[model samples]
Target: MKNRTILLTGGGTAGHVSLNQALIPELKNLGFNVEYIGSKDGIESGLIPDSFPDVPYHAIASGKLRRYFSVKNFTDPVRVGAGLVQALNVIRKTKPVAIFSKGGFVSVPVAMAGKLMSVPVIIHESDVTPGLANKIAMPFANHIFTVFKETLKHVPKEKSTCTGSVIRSELMDGSAAKGKEICNFNNDLPVLMVMGGSQGSAVINEAIRSNLTALLKQYNVIHLCGKGNADSSLMDLANYKQFEYVTHELPHLLHMTDFVVSRAGSNSIFEFLALKKPMLLIPLSKLKSRGDQILNARLFQQQGFAHVVEEEELTPERFLAEMQKLQMDEDLLVDAMTNAESPKTAYEMAKLVAAHTKN
Candidate 1:
């Protein structure tokens, strides 16, 4: 395996990139060389370089796979064609044993190139249903890994496996004491973590702000408000803290969290579930998204891991009510999470990739 170089590609959002981040350490431990392909300006280019400094990073042209009509739609196909050529050139040079993609638009070209170059390509889909990018890349993919068992029916059964979400080991290393120290939160009050993906959600932030007085009565809040979403005026409030985002401190933050209020992004929800945190989920409405998050939230609710309130209905009053219900059932959520059957999926997925590399 030390002689094998595995090419990895995914980007656009933290969800797409973080799964690859979770797998990198395991891949390195398995003694494979890692090389990442991402867009020149996607979130991956910024995150992967810093997270995997030892791994070689390659940038390629990428286009967004928009579901709506827009002027950019006219030119994005041209960019996609160019990206395919760029990926082909890189694949020819790297000649990787296999390519594993987390399925962003950036991955589609690389997956096609891998197919043309006679290299096996594996893709991981993190949602309950495949995203548009994964749908495009599936034909080129030799195997597809899914985070949810329900996602299997949506893809070609022969190529799909419900491997579950890859929960990063780093997340479990967070210290409650260290988290308290970092956030200036006291152990007397329960800590609530509010996260809205990497970009942060305006609705979530605004609801938290509008309800801070009431929320602070029972819980201290550690808000990861995304880049530029922090309110300077709220800095002086006790039992409340906000950050644009956390890099190294997220594990600690998770450790301190007794309950979570979050968007229903599959990656974020699964990480919360892995930690046994009771969650109140506000999924992105169909108006704003492809409705995957809505499905994610509902399934988590059905599985007894979370409670869901759609974005259209997510006022501070409703959020607070749901939080109270979640708090009352905290023990139940923990019990369900404890008995949940996703042990070592990340390791197994890594091993599967390694096996394919040999073929």
Candidate 2:
């Protein structure tokens, strides 16, 4: 039997790589050879090879896809063009049955190469609106899976499916006791996990710290403080713990987390929803992003899965108020989350790739 091969592409932010991560083992379980095509130094470079040592990995020239003017813009396209040539060669060599993209700048060139090479391409969009990279790659996608039903309208209707989010099976395996053990928290207090994506958020770190004493009184705080963001002075706080990030232990952390405070990245929030953890989402300000996080936060709030606070509205007082609100409505949020559908989109996607492989 011929090896069924699928090439995965996504990077930049941890959000971009998350769906691809969810799909990796699922594809492997279906007997397809899993490999990744990513930028040489993006987050994918660290995550893919390290997390899935068995998966063959390739690095290619990659350029950032920017929406605004910058001096790097001119040079980046040259890199992007080079990436296309490199990607075309890689796809030709691998002869993958299908290409799956989770939408990042690195993916744009690869998707274009897949189109030129006649390999079927599948792209998953985690936002209500497509990012700059996916918009460019839309013409190449054989199918576009979306996390939100609302997002379908933004893409070619004939090619789009609302598959919800791709959540890894391991994300749901968290045990509260194991989580408590890992974080060294007392069971006497509820655990509150704060995540600000992979690199952490300076704004969130400040807000939490300014209110740390007040917050620690009510809950045991576990802060994923981003790289270089942890404060040594606060290390001695009895009810608080801080780490740069958690990976293998994330499931356990999630299992132990009774409530959450986080930025409203779609991938992260959806995972939190799957765990039925009530959340207070502080979306990245429009000044910081294209306001995707803001939209994501609002939608989750509307669905009763979380409470939303805009960055402009973020303050210690308001943060605590929202936390109080989240605590008061915990049962309702859990009920909403319980009834919510997890499309298990990665499996649906794996089936799609399998069908393409068979054909």
Model 1's TM-score against the true structure = 0.97
- For this target, which candidate reaches the highest lDDT against the unseen true structure? 1
lDDT of 1 by residue, 153-210 (tens): 8999997887777787888888988998998865598999999889999999988999
RMSD of candidates 1 onward, in order:
1.2, 1.4
Candidate 2 per-residue lDDT over residues 1-359, each given as its tens digit: 24878999999989998778878888888878888999999989999898899988889899887778999999999999999999998888888989989888999999999988889998889998888899999999898888899998799999888877767778877687898887787659898999988989988998899998888889999999998888999888778989997788889888988999999998899989988899999999988888888889999989889988887888889888889999999999999999998647567767765775526
Q: How far is candidate 2 from the true structure (C-alpha RMSD, Å)?
A: 1.4
lDDT of each: 0.89, 0.87
TM-score of each: 0.97, 0.97
Find the 10 residues in a row with the least total lDDT in model 1: 341-350
